[model samples]
Target chain A: MLDIKNLHVKLEEEDKVILKGVDLKIEPGSVHAIMGPNGSGKSTLSYVLSGRAGYEVTDGSVTLDDVDILDMEPEERAAAGLFLAFQYPVEIPGVGNMTFLRTAVNAQRKARGQDEMSAAEFLKVIREKAKTLQIDADMLKRPVNVGFSGGEKKRNEILQMAMLEPKMCILDETDSGLDVDAMKLVSEGVNALRDAGRSFLVITHYQRLLDHIKPDVVHIMSDGRLIKSGGPELALEVEQNGYADLKADAGAV
Target chain B: MARADLKKEKHEATEARISTLNMPQGGTWASMARNEALSRLRGMGLPARRDEYWKYTRPDTLIQQDAPAAALFDSLEPAVFDSVDRLKIVFVDGVFDAAASDDLSLSGVEIDRLETAAAADIHWAKDVYGRLEARGQTPVARPLAALNSAYATDGILIRVTGKAAKPISLIYTHKSEASDAILHHVIKLEKGAELTVLENGPAASRFNKVMEVEVADGAKFHHIRAQGRDHERRAATHLFTRLGSESLFKSFTLTVNGALTRNEAVIEFSGDNAVAHIAGAAMGDGAFHHDDTVFITHDAVNCESRQVYKKVLRNGAVGVFQGKILVKEGAQKTDGYQISQALLLDDDSQFLAKPELEIYADDVACSHGSTTGAIDQDALYYLRSRGVTKKEATDLLVLSFMAEAVEEIEDESLREEIVTRLTGWLERRSG
Candidate 1:
């Protein structure tokens, strides 16, 4: 459902290349994990896809279901069913969590020319979705992510994903700050949403998360290039030995 | 001209205006107060551009004799207190429209029109008429309030002896195109009494209003006002208050767009163990100039006072805040907090703030801060990334910025009313 080809990106403020001629594709319903060391442009690729500013797309293209998303604004891309679960969910003071979610859901719906959800309708569905994520009424009432724990933030992101129901989901280091139980809960939430039409890109540095939400495809991103592609066994090999030899073999050190 | 000559010339100009006032013939006490205010105004004159307090906000429009023309704004929403059970006092073109008002009848309170009090041989309002304005004359010259005192044609004199059964809502509606209106109100809360005052208005094309409140020992007084959305209106309003021992007083103001709006409040903590909070939220779009000048004094021990003001300016709108907290000698254990913040949505908009703290007590705690900032870029991006467009995200952030000040309102329904009105303003502005 998602395709990328020869994507090259650089920092807009400084003349430093981040991604150099990178490429990959994910089939519909398939889950892919992109594992890389620090500064390997894994997060950069996610940000560029999400239309974040200040990252100049030096060259290349990214498409979701054969539709060009490069020219769309971040919100437009979101309206086009692109979702990015941020590594660090931002703290937005003075805006209630439920209000933010309702506004988002309706905003996307409005952009798609669908009928907006009524307050009662929104409350009913949110309560049901939140029940599965273990988010209480108080968590929904509090300001967005303000004073939330790391686990709660990740779960909140999952709740959003479940509510938005985007076609493609990119989790940028979603497991970095989560504890073992939290990771299991999050992975369970993700696993429950897996469907024939949905796709996932789980970007991470560790292999422990993949144990819960097993990936169908694995790619080793080294120095801004995905040099190695394999099956789920490739993640086990990296977990056992690390990426030092892989980077050396790829000549990306 | 030299500065001294310029000051003399400006004073003469003020004298000219004061001499032309249509003084009300009234009781000895009322006449005495008006004459005193006239003399005081003559001495201070109207505020000049060079005056320290008037530097950021020009006083020419406010001090002029003729009010500029303003078309009455037809509001789609009902008045804020329409749903509340209240005693409605309606004013048209600054004149009390008795036909459009409820009878002056409420348990545990006494209400009389200022004109009635002025015509009486003896009345309680004589004691307060222009007294607080005269007291507020020190350290700064509130000549406009004095002028309001000297020439105001209509108002209410209220005395609460016990808890009021219902809120008192004073509403002002526009009638004349170029009406210059002045109104004065005096409120006295007896010991252990409680009262809530709600006011909403586009008083006139140009309106000058003053309200003086005295809270006795253990009394509670709450006030919430919404200045109207008359786009071309000019208004200068003042609230003067004195709190007695163990008394509580709180006031909140919401100012929408107007050509020029100056809201000044002077408060004194006269007795120990009193608490007072004054907060306001204002929104201004293009061609809007809004100013809030507040002076709060802590003269009693163990008294607490807070001043919170927030403003959102966009598209060349101008906002000004000048606030001060003063703790007097022997007022030990006093607590004072002051904060003023502004969110400028565009580069062309401007915010000027001056915050001061003066303390002579050794054991008092007083802190004041002022801040001006643009919308947080990270927060904006995060909201937009969630599918909210840039405009909606900005409106949410702006409303959030003003939420703290709006929270100072103690009534839930009234607070929600203000929030709803604010949302409407943002929608209209963004649209």
Candidate 2:
């Protein structure tokens, strides 16, 4: 469902390479977990995939379901069934969470030539989603991500992903600031949306979040490149041994 | 040059004579009010370049010549009201149109023109009309106050009895083609009375002026004014609201189309537990200039006041917002807030916002904020990325900036109507 070929990204000001010729491909019905230490370009990959501004893509191409996404804007990529669960969600004051969600959902629907949802129908769908996410109706009425806790913001991101029902979702450090219980809750929310035709790329520093939503493939990133690719047991190995050995191995390679 | 000097000398002489004549005195407060007007006029003549508040909105053009003491009292042509469902009160050259006004008498309320009221009841006229004394040091010393005091001949007099249910709409229409016009309205809400007043000037009229409103204890007053004057015309309006104990005063002023307009609303919370909300929105395009200056005072304890002003400037237009919140020394627990935001759509457009807070009370919560910026580029790009045209995206963001002031309007139909008008203006201006 997603492909990145020889992707190289650099800072616009200093021209320092962040993503160095990284290549990855994910098929439908599978979850890919990219485990790396600090400064390993995990979030950079997510931002590059999401088409955020200010990233200089010196080399390579990205495709979503055989459609080139490097030419698309962030919102255009979103409308094309690509979602990014930001690590630090934006705080939009005076814009209610429900209103923002409805706008995003209806925008995607309108792009796909579907009928818009009425207020009553939207209320019903949002109520059901909030029940599953354990988000109160009052919380949905507040401004988008304003004054929300770290875990609550993560949960809201997942709720948006659920409402959007994107074909591919990249969760960038979704468990960075969450407690153990919140991590489990957010993982469960992501797992509930899993299906045969959907794909996910989970980026994390710790392996505990992977315990809840198991991945089929785990890749260890070192020095801006995927140095190791293995089955799910690779995550357990990294958990016990850490990425120090992987970093040395990548240096030698 | 000699002719010009002689004209200036003549003007100064006339102004001196107008200032010396004592205001009509009858009741107890009449002499005090008259003396205050005279002193204020004496202290400050029509605002010039020296005054900081009136620096941008120069009143020199408005005071080209002294307006006559009495407006043209001849009957006016019938008003054109085809689409709206509102009851119209037409004022031709600043005089009330008795033949065209409706006698749909609302219960427990007296809706009469100001001239008729002044002729009939001197006490009521003296008590309610021309009261414009600021609490401390009259910051923006209005020289026009004296001019309105000396020359306003007719206006709308609205007195709502206790707890009146139906609202009275006073539509002040200016239908003059040849001469400059001045219309003053004095609205009084008796104790515990509730009233909603809508005042709109003619769409394509020339020079016009209006003044003071008086509200009583526990009363609720809503005032909405709109101006759509001709591009060559200029209008000045002063709304002085005096609030009593526990009264609620809400005002919304919208200036969508005008050549040069300056609206000043002074709200004084004279008694305890009074609450006031003042919201304004203005749009200026094609060399139009609009200015709104607001002064809100918390003279009593536990009084609350809020002011929010928003402006949109395009083409070579200019917009100004000068808001001040004053809290007296003994006015404890007074909560006052003011915010002004402006959006400049073009490089030539300009916006100036000065929000000030003067607090003398120790236990008061007061804050003032101002922001001037172009539209958010990220939000604009986000909207445009979603297949929305650039104009549509710009309109949406502009409408969102104005939504706060528009949402404060409680009248649902009126709110929607104003929003529609705003959208249409945005469309026309951008197109």
Candidate 3:
């Protein structure tokens, strides 16, 4: 459902290259996790796919359902069923959480030429979804991400993903600041949306998240490319023996 | 060349401007008050570019010999506050329109036109006509307010003895392109009484207005004003209010689409344990210049005052804010908070702010802050990434930036009206 081939990205304000010739593909109804150390361009890959600013895709192509997404704006990409759950969700001081979610839902619906959701209908759906994530009415009423705890932020992102129901979802370090309980709650929320048509690209530094939401495939990214691809057991190997040996092996290759 | 010659020239120029205005003919007390205001205006002269308070905003358009011509705007949108139940008082081109206004009588309150009340031999309005405006001139000179007090031709006088049944709505409609309108309103709330006043619409092409409010002990006063939507109209408005012991005063203004507007609010706390809040939200696009100058003084023990002002400007628009909070000696436990922020949508827009705090009370808590910034790009991206268009995202951010000032409105319906207007203003400029 998602494809990235020869993705070579460099910082727009600098000549330094981030993602150099990275390639990955994920099929429908599957979850793929990318494990890497710091500065390994894993997060950069997610940002490039989401069309974030400050990066120039020098040479690469990304597609969702065989439609080229490189030329689309961020909102267009979103309307085209691309979603990125930010690691650090932005703190908007005055935009209420409910208002933001409703606006986003209606905006995407209008972009897709579908009927907008009514306020009553939206409140019903959000309340049910929020219950599963332990997000209460107060959290939904307050400004988006303002004064939110780390776990609350992560769960809020999951709630957004649930609301949007995108064809492809990219989670960039969703487990970074979350505790064990939050990880399980978020993993359950993600697992609930694992339908036949949805796909996930989970980028994380640790395998603890994989323990909660099992991945069909795991990739070990060393420099700017995926050096190894294997099953869930690969995560165990990396957990026991860190990326030090993997880096040496990739360099030798 | 010398200071004396400069003063004499300024005095003569002010007199020339005054000679062109037709003072409203009234009875003994009203005429005396107008004459006194005239002398005060002469002493201060009209605001000049060299004046410290007028440095950021030019006073030329406000004090010019002839009112500059402005094209009338035909708005298809319904007037704000239409949904609320209010006593409507209409003014067309600065002249009171009795036929279009509601009955002047309301339970628990007495309301009369300034022309009629001033024509009476004895009236309660005589005590408040320009008293607060005169008191507001100390430590700073507001010659434009003095000019309005001296030559105002029409207004309303309200005295509240009990809780008002509904808000008194003063609607100003501009019908003449070159109409230079001057109006002064006086409101007196008796002990333990309460009242709310609503003002809206563009009065005229060139408008000067003053409102003086006196809140007696334990009384309450609320004011919400929306400046007219005529894009080429110019206005200078002043609100002078004094709060007595245990009284409460709150005022808010929303300004949209004016060529130039200067709104000044001066509040004084005279009795212990009083509270006052003044806030404004302004949006200006091309050729728009909006200014908000506020001075709040805490002179009684344990009084609280807040000033919140926010402005959104784009396409070379300019916004200025000069807010000060003064805590006098022996006014222990006084609390004063002031914040003025501007969101510049583009690099071409400008925001100039001067926040000052002069305190002599060691036990007082007074804080002031001012900021100018562009739209938060991170927040914008977060919104756009959620499938909202770039324009919509920017508008959301702008609204969020101004929400603080808008929240100062206490009434839910009034606040909603202001929010709706804010949204409409953003939508109209999106094109």
Candidate 4:
């Protein structure tokens, strides 16, 4: 349902290119994992797709279900069913988590020309979704990630993903700061949301996260290009050994 | 001869300004205080633009010969504290309207009009009528407050002996665009008594107001005021309070759109173990200028004082804060804190502040800080990404910045009401 064609990006403030000639395509109802080493343009690709500021798209285009998302505003991209579970979730000091969620949900609905959700309906759905992700009422009541632990922030991100229920999801290094238990809880939350119409692009440096979520397609990326693509066995291969051999192979290919 | 001629001309000009206002005639003590205040005004004159304390704010509009014409504000919402059951004292264009005011009957308190009390044969309010304003003249020349004392003819006199049943509210309503209102109120709380006072509405196009309060030992006093929303009003108000041993005093002001506003508060602790907290939140937009000048003194042992002020300015609005805390000698273990902050919503808005601390005590803890900043870009982006509109995001952040001061209100219900009012203000601007 999501397509990226010959994408190229660079830092807006500097003349430094981060993503060069990267291409990817995800089919509907499939989980694709992008495995890359450090500075492989993994996070830059996600930011460019999510319409973050200060990122110049030198070339190429990103589309969600045949709709051009790069031309849309960040909020418009959100309304277009793009969800980015950030690597480091932002901390808002005074905006309550519940209020943030409600605003986001209603805004997206309003943009889509749908009826606004009432506070009572929002509270009920958020409570049920939060329970599954191990988020208590207090976490939802407090300011967004202001004083949460590392594990709690990751889980709250998952809670947001659950509430938004986007058609396409991008988890950029979601396992970097999570503990093993947190990883299981997050994976379970993702697994519960899996359906025939929604697609996920899980980006990570380690293969342990793939073991829990079980990607249908694994792509090895180095130097901003996907060199090899295979089934789940490719993730195991990179885990058992290291990316040292894969790096040479990617370079040669 | 040139210098002497210049001084004489300046004195004549000042005399001309003071001659326009009529001095309230109270019996012996009131007359004496008015004479002294008038003499002080003669020396100090109206504040000039070059004066040190008036450097950031211009006082010319307030001291002008006629009250400037201000368009009357028509609010669809009821005046603040209307739902809260209160003893209402109504004033129409600086003059007390007996027909609109409730009977001066409240349990645990005695009340009277300043004009009548000054004219009466016997009254306890004579002791505090203008004494605090006179005391405030030192260390700084508040000629405007002194001017109020000399000329103000109408206000309320309150004496509390026990816990009040409900709040006493002063409601000012205006019908004339050129009305100039000068009001001076006096309040006294006896030993171990408690009371809450509230003031609301834009009294007139041009207004000068002063309120003097004295809290006896172990007494408590709470004040909450809403300086009305006349966009072209030029108002100058002063609050003078003194706290006795183990007494507590707290005051908060919500100031809004005005052509010019100067709110000055002077507080002194006379007895040991007293506490005072003064806070204000002001929001101004489009040709508005607001000022808060406060001075707090700790004279007794183990007393605490706090001053918190926050302002939000947009569309070339100007805000000023000048606050000072002084700890006297032998007043050991004194605790004082002061913070003034402003959130400028645009590039054109301005905030000017001068925070000072004077400490002679050996073991006192005093800290003061001032900051002016724009809304956090990251916070704004975060809110926007979550689907909040740009306007809505900005209003939320501005409210959060001013929330710290709003939370200082002790009464929960009143605090909530003020918050709703602030939120409504933001909503109108954002829309």
Candidate 5:
């Protein structure tokens, strides 16, 4: 479902390589977790995949479902069934959450030559999905992420991912600000959306979230390169014995 | 010859033909006012670009030698207010249409033509007719006021006695077949009276001039002026309002269509516990130019004022906003806020906003801000990504910008009416 070949990205002004000769592939029906320390280019990789502004793709290419997405704009990438759940969702004042969500969903539908959803239909679907995520109807009526609590904002992000139903989902540090209960609820939301034809790349600093949504493959990253690839037991080992041992191994390599 | 000298020569020629300008020869007061207006017109001359207030709005196109003093009233048409339930006073080419107006008997409210009322109620006319004359002389000079004072043959005079509920609609229509034309109006609301006035101008008139209001002690006044005109027509209006103790004054001006338009409103809070709200929106396209200048004075303690102006400029249009709030000494506890924002839709469009606040009183809350920028690209993209077309996205953003001002309107029906008109304007632009 997703492929990145020898991808190298750098900052525009400094020319400092953030993602250096990284390669990854994920087939449909599988969940992959990328565990990394600080400054390991986890967010950078997500931005590069989502085509955010100011990140230059200096080398290699990225393809989603055999379609090259490096040249697409952010909205184009979004319309092409690629979704990125931001670590810090933008706070857009004066724009209601429901309005923004409906616009995003309709935009993707229109891009795929599908009929637009009416306001009533959108309201019904969103209300039902919001209940499962513990988001109140009133919160959905407020401006997007404006004055929202940490847990509520994270839940809102999951609500959006549920509404969009992208083919490939990238969760960038989705577990950073969540409490114990919130982490479980968010993981449940992700697990509910799992299917045979969908794929997910969950990025995190801690292995706690991995306990809820088990991944088929776990990759340890250090200094912008995947240092180790193993099974779900790798996450438990890293959680028990920190990344200090992994650091020594990476240094020797 | 220099341009100034040529302009002076043109003015002299226009003055020579003032008498034979083919205006109707009505009653004694009308003739007298016309004669005095001719002399005043000769003395003051036409407004030049050098004048500070007229710097941006030059009156050269209105000073043609063959320009008739009286606009042709034969082709004048009634407006949409004909179906409304309020009392309608019609003014064609600055003259009252007594036969077309309705005769409603309301206690404590006096509605009559200015020229005719001067004979019956001389004291009232003398007290408030030229009250703004002394103040219009210096600081910011208004040649249009001088011209209107000199040439205004007839206008509508409304006086509400105490706490009245009904509203008054003044309909002024200008119809000109040959050269440009002008119409001036003066209105006064007395102490303790509450009233709403709606001023609707001609849809395709050439040139119209107005100097309209005065508010007395403890009164509340609401003024809404809607101007829609053709690309060749020009319109200018100056509205001056004075609020007394515990009084409230609100004014909303909407200029949707015009070639060249200027609307200036000056509000003075002369007594304590007074409040003023001034809001306006201008929509321009093609070469249409709309300029709005507002000055509000907080003279007494516990007075408050707010001014919000928004403009949407498209095609090759230009929009300008100049707003100032003045806090006088000893006017403590005064709250004055002003904001002016513009949205430029096309590359050829232009917007200039200048917001100023001058404070002398201590312990007063005063602030002013001005912003000129294009629509938010992210917001637009977000809307478009929702399946809304590009035009729909732009229209929604523009509507939201103008909605801030429209929401300030107190009347629900009137607010909805303005929004409908705004949507129509956006639709026309999109098409």
Candidate 6:
């Protein structure tokens, strides 16, 4: 459902290369995890796919269901079913959490030429979704992510993912700051939305999170390129041996 | 020119402007007050470009003899405070319209016209007509308010002895192209009394207004006003209030779409343990210049004051803020806070701020902050990444920037009304 080919990216303000000659593909109804050491360009790949600023795509193409999304604005990319769960959710001081979600949901729907959801209907749906995420009325009423705990922020991101229902989801270190219980809760939320047409690209530094969501494919990304691809056992190998030996082995290859 | 010559020239200009105005005939006390105000204005002279307080804002148009012509703005939106049940006092180009106004009778309060009260032999307004204006001139000069007190044609005088059931709404409508309107209002709140005043409109092509409020011991006063959306209009307004012991005062103003507007508020704490808050939200687009000047004095012990002002400017619009907090000797335990922020949507817009604190008391806590910036890119991208259009996201952030000032309104309905107007302004400019 998602495809990337020889993606080349560099910092827009400087000549430093971030993602160099990277390529990956994910099928429909599948879960993939990209594990790498620090500064291996895992986050850059995700950012490039989401159309964030300050990154120049020197070469390459990324597509969702064979439709190119590289030229679209961030909002248009989001409306076209591309969602990126940020590592650190922005804290907006004045926009309420529920208001932000409603605006997003309606905006995406309107962009897709679908009828907007009524306020009453939205409230009912959000209440149901929030209950599963353990987000209370007060949290929804408060400003977006202002004074929110790590667990609450992750759960809020999951809640947004569930509401937007994007076709392809890129989780950028969603488990970075989450506790054990929060990881379980977030993984459960992600697991619940695993439909036949939805795909996930989980980027992580540890296997503890994979234990909860259970990806089908694992890739070892080193030096801005995916050098190793294998079954779920690959994640266990990296967890046990670390990326040091993998880098040497890839160099030997 | 030498300093003496400059002063003489300014005084001569002030005299020239005063010579053209015909002071209304009134009672002994009123006439005496007008004469006092005229002399005070002459001493200070009108604001000039070289004045320290008027550096960021020009005073030529506001101080000129003939009011500049302004094309009437045709607004489809309903007048502010139309939904609230209020005692309406309508004014067409500064002339009181009795036929369009409610009767001058309400329980717990006494309402009278300044024209009528000033002509009487003895009236309660005689003590307040120019008293507060004259008091506010020291330390800094406000010649415009002095001029208003001296030659204002008509205004409302309200005296509240108890809780007012409904708010008194002052609505101004402009019909003449070159109308120059001057109005002065006096509000007297007795001990433990409470009152709310609501004002809205573009009074005339060139409008000058002064409102004097005396909040007695333990009294409460709330004021919410909106300067109308007349793109070519010019206005200068002053609010001078004195708070007695344990009294409370809060005022909020929302301004949008005017060519030139200068709003000044001076508050003095006369007795101990008083609280006062002044806030404003202004939005200006091309050819617009809005200024907010505030001075708060803490004279008694343990008094609190807050000043919050926010402005949104785009397309070469200009905004100015000059705020000061003065804590006098013996005014220990004073808590004073001031913040002025501006959000400039484009590179052409400008914001100038001067925040000052003068403290003679060592045990006072006073802080002031001023900032001018563009939209937060991180926040903007976060919103756009969530599928919100860039325009909608910008509007949301703009509203959020002004939310601090708007939140100062004590009434929920009034806050919502202000928010609706802000949203409408953003939406109208979205394209």
Which is the leading candidate under lDDT?
Answer: 6
Displacement of the residue B222 alpha carbon in candidate 5, Å: 3.6
Q: Give each prediction's root-mean-square deviation over alpha carbons.
A: 1.7, 5.6, 1.4, 2.6, 5.3, 1.3
Pick the winner on DockQ between candidates 1 and 3: 3
Better of 1 and 6 by DockQ: 6
| Range of the 10 consecutive residues with the lowest summed lDDT in candidate 2 chain A | A90-99
Give each prediction's DockQ, rounded to 2 decimals. 0.72, 0.15, 0.82, 0.52, 0.22, 0.82
Q: Candidate 1 docking: what grade?
A: medium
lDDT of 3 by residue, A176-251 (tens): 9999999999999999999999999999999999999899999998778898899999999999999888888878
Task: Compose the digit string of candidate 1's lDDT tens values, residues B1-431.
Answer: 79898889788779777766798888888888888998888888888888899999999888766888999888887877788889999999899999999999999999999998998888898778899889998888999999999899999999999999998999999878899889999999999999999999888999999999999999999999999668999999999999999999999999997899999999999999999999999999899999999999888999999999999998999999999998889999999999999999989999999999999999988899999999988788888888999999998898879978998998999888898889888887653
In model 3, which regions exceed 4 Å deviation?
Answer: none
Q: Residue by residue across B244-358, what tens digits does model 2's lDDT show? A: 9999998987787666788888888889999899998888887688888888888899998989889988888899888898888899999998889998887989888778888
Each candidate's number of clashing pairs is 0, 0, 1, 0, 3, 0
Candidate 5 per-residue lDDT over residues B1-431, each given as its tens digit: 78778668747755654543454344555444445555555665666666555555566655444442333323233343444467777776556677866773456777766556645523354545545643544345555555665555566667677655556777766655443445555667787778887777652344546555667778888877677644555666777777788888888888876677878777778889988999998999886888888878788899889998999998888888888888888999999989998888879988877678888988999888888889877556445433345676677678777877876788877776677678777876653
> Which tens-of-lDDT digit does each residue in A100-133 have in candidate 1?
9999999999999999999999999999989988
Ranking by TM-score: 6, 3, 1, 4, 2, 5
DockQ of 6: 0.82
DockQ of 1: 0.72
**DockQ of candidate 5?**
0.22
Question: lDDT per residue, candidate 3, B1-431, as tens digits?
Answer: 77787788778779889989988899999999999999999889998777899999999899988899988999999999999999999999999999999999888999999999889788998888899999999989999999999999999999999999999999999999999999999999999999999999999999999999999999999999998589999999999999999999999999999999999999999999999999999998999999999998888999999999999999999999999998899999999999999998889999999999999999988888999999887788788888989999998998899888888999999999999999988888853
- The candidate with the higher DockQ, 4 or 6, is 6
**Model 3 chain B poorest 10 in a row by lDDT:** B1-10
Q: For each candidate, what is chain B's TM-score?
A: 0.98, 0.86, 0.98, 0.97, 0.85, 0.99
lDDT of 2 at A98: 85
- For candidate 3, give the lDDT of residue B59: 91
Off by over 4 Å in 4: A236-242, B1-10
What is residue B301's positional error in candidate 5, in angstroms?
1.1
Worst 10 residues of 3 chain A by lDDT: A244-253
Query: What would you estimate as the lDDT of candidate 1?
Result: 0.92
